[model samples]
Target: MTTATRTLQLKAAPLIVEAEKEKKPVKVRITAYTGGIMTVPGWGPVIIDLQGLDLPQRVTLLLDHEGRTEATIGWGIPKTDGKTLVIDGTVTEATDAGKLVIALLKDDVPLQASVGVETNQYRPLKPGDTITVNGQTITVESDTFLIEGGILREVSVVPLGADKQTMVTLAAGVRNMTHQPAPPENSSPGETIEAKYILDLLSVCGDDMSTFRQAIENRLPLETAKALAETRRRPVIPPVLNAEVKDTPASILAAAALKLLGKESLAEKELGAETLSAAASYKPRTALDLCGMACQMSLGYAPRGTNEIIRAAFSTTDLPVALGVAANKIALDAYQQAPATWKSFARIVSAKDFKEHTGIRLTGDFKLEELAAHGEIRHANVGEETITYKVTTYAKMLMLDRQHIINDDIAILDQIPTIFGRAAARKVADLVYTVLLSNPGGFFSAAHSNLITGAESGLSVASLAEAIAALRKQTDADGLPLDLVPRVLLVPPELEATARQVLNSVELYRSGGDQLPAGNPFAGLNIALEVEPRLSNTYFPGNSTAAWYLLCGPADGSFLVAFLNGQQGPTIEPVDPGADKLGTGWRCYIDIGAAAADWRCAVKASGA
Candidate 1:
């Protein structure tokens, strides 16, 4: 649980699936904290993503020693030994499930008189072995007897060539393991035992930073605890997988950062992730902050926090005396033993407690008081204060050996703006699509939001008013899409009159006087806003609106979200960063009612 005051090196490094063949720490890759520290087994060829390093390059770290081995672990992928479980007599009639039915005459296991026969992964049946079920140990009876959910289902076996590592998925969901009065005399310790991937590493690391440190720092291969100096480490458990990552835009990422650091005021006092997201779609950094505040949010759903901000105040220092549950791997990335949830793991990290649990010890010069306080510049404590964070993240397209670094394509980014709203979406859409419309290389979210940027000359904040005034000239243009396009960016509620002028239009005889073709199904429609605070690219928790099929085609104009305070509250408000909130934000998503219905007239005439 405790980190080292000296060097925070890789501990009990687990060999990435194919790590053995590759030599040296140079091959080590940095995957993100799957909620906790990981074992760096040794060396291999790999891609490394470090702090400030978006594109992965080659980097290496020399491992002190591999982990010490424990007792003969269980589930050591055992094989059939070229033998099979045999039923001598004859096959009986097939059961409804198509299983062969057999009547037991003489049984190998004296405990039970009969046995069931079925075709499993490999061999048919074996002999001379005891088949146990729910504490009932029995040998193979003459041939086979009908049985279901018995030994085959209860006991896990290895295939002919498997090396005894338990399947991560199978190990994650197991509980109250099928026990016997006495386990088979021949089964290996780990074979009958459930493999707790994430926790298993923690258990080996234990609660003490020094001991855990030595265990990992030593880089001892999977040896016994007796061989190496103890690294007492209490594990900071990983979070359980409960949320899924869906489509989010890149603007959402940028916008969140702006809102959080800007510290915008809002109506709600609670100020959680949901409300913040709905209130300001343009600010994403704030949403990322919200995600870390709640234990429930996870990378599978929104993988934007930690990397986006500095989180020194929240690191764990406490120790854990006992484990509540085992760790499971839900993500396909990283090792197969990641935990589904590690909130409990974090709560215990504030104090020095790992020594008693894990055999590792916390060596070096640091103390608890010094580590928990603010950042400092003391030469003596520098080594202890620094953290060696290891991450192993994977993305579809990685840029390497290129003229310049990869750029974020704003278009693809829009699809994943986990914390954006209608206005932000429109802006991002325009930016992304516009870039696509202009660039020959095409559009990508990474290139747009992070990569592509406008020069300072593009437009200054002071000149924004002039731009709005100039835009007004086109508000009532003869053949433009709108007499005046909505000038939502940088314009606040104080500019409502200006907004109204643009939306309603300065002129009446405009070419296009409709929302979008007639009967747009969603015409006159309204929507409900799901607000969040501090979480990035996250949706409102379980508050999804009912799904309704749209009647209008692709060109149909539709309304997504319209802000409202409440039943008796105002829908829109002027920007007032000085106040906690100007008014409550609400929404109404609608479809174009009539193609020829003057949109400006309808909006201007409405009470809103």
Candidate 2:
């Protein structure tokens, strides 16, 4: 409010006076401001003392607030009528911008007025404070500064104004409005919009000076100029491309490896049909050829020698990642092909991190209690038992030397990574079987009534029935029968045929001197047979070919194989090869753990 000067723009409707149709100069009357309390943006509430308002005999009327010579519409004599400041003016200019005001007046359209003032003397007032100005009692509802003394510099005709109650009037039928020369034929109605108005609009839309100059030169309408400015203001967006350009170099290399292995069909299936078609182009390349491509793509030059190519490729980021991804794909394929007997009898779960994962078993109170009539059922606190385990990182490194690349052996890439994958799978299987064979916490014991040993406890129809019955008769933490069923028959590789025969045969028979056939009760039971070679391997501390187990489905929470973050297979990572090293190296690793979860769901036979 204390700024050097401030302009308060107010809207006014032109009042049509008595007709002067033959007059050469059209005259009009306007109430610039119905002086009272007005809210000015930034300045807040402002009260103008009408008596202190200074007026000139011939105040220039400018278009908007440009103040240029061409913007002068005409001059007007301003006077006060106790409360409102009125202006009597004439339409005396012929400029295109001024003509818009003349046209509005000639057609009896309303006009707006804005008065610029210089604040010379003022008094600030607090809320609810009363002050006397020009014999009128004014009580401010908010903090405001009263303009006790000010000079009315000039007035302007704007398309829109801040205040909406003032009025402007044109004499009726004063048809010959323009008193000056006509505009050129090239001029347009868009010219009526002031350049400053257009500039302000462009500035709001974040347009440069070039765009503003274009709008002025072309004399574009307000809406059209706004649209152009908006279009240029938007952020630029990039276009989308197909897989050949979109896919990473690593993924492309993996697809190419599949192509080299003469398994192009699998490559399409492994990576969607559209995935490898563009990158591999149905062609295969050796390890050496791949290194050369990587060098050319990354270093922008063809490889010189096999040794340099291998060194340079290993040095670059994309080449190592590409090689790692290719190796991982091959390793994963082999890992899947390798047998994992644990999957059939144990549940597979994921660990989030190295932190120990607690498996909570809810029991006892889970059974619903009876409810009384018109009474709510009470909540029960179920019994909980937890087992904790954490995943461990297992890894090994493989080095691919210059000679290996020089020989251009694709088989090395295929066989080495495959071995790593199988090894990783074997590691997981070993962990799971170790926990089972260790019989941690007596998982299979006489106290639990799940372990059986006798002459008839060997692999036979009667032994399977007894094991299944024992598993089904097992109790919960509260001594309630779990009602479990045998879903899998686990045995050593040596007993695979016998175990299968026990479940698949239509009739069972004695293996001793007696060959008489007995009834096969397990023939119709859909029990899966899983044979693990490690169960009988001497590498383990307790290896037994004659020992076998009957287990419940994985959902019964008998045992679980947990992989970190659900990454079931191993991952291959490239190692940085420094100056001393002559070859590239990759470390393949897996995060995994295993443990026996519950004892009630499994029954073991000694087969003595």
Output the number of the TM-score-best candidate.
Answer: 2
lDDT of each: 0.20, 0.67
Off by over 4 Å in 2: 1-245, 281-284, 303-308, 509-518
Question: Global CA lDDT of candidate 2, please?
Answer: 0.67
lDDT of 1 by residue, 25-109 (tens): 1111221111111111110101111121111111111111000111111111111211111111111122211111111111111
TM-score of each: 0.18, 0.57
* Residue 262 lDDT (model 2): 69
- 233-330, model 2: which lDDT tens digit per residue? 33111111011222334455556666776656756766656657744752446777776655444333334666666765554445555566667778
Off by over 4 Å in 1: 1-77, 82-465, 468-488, 493-498, 505-608
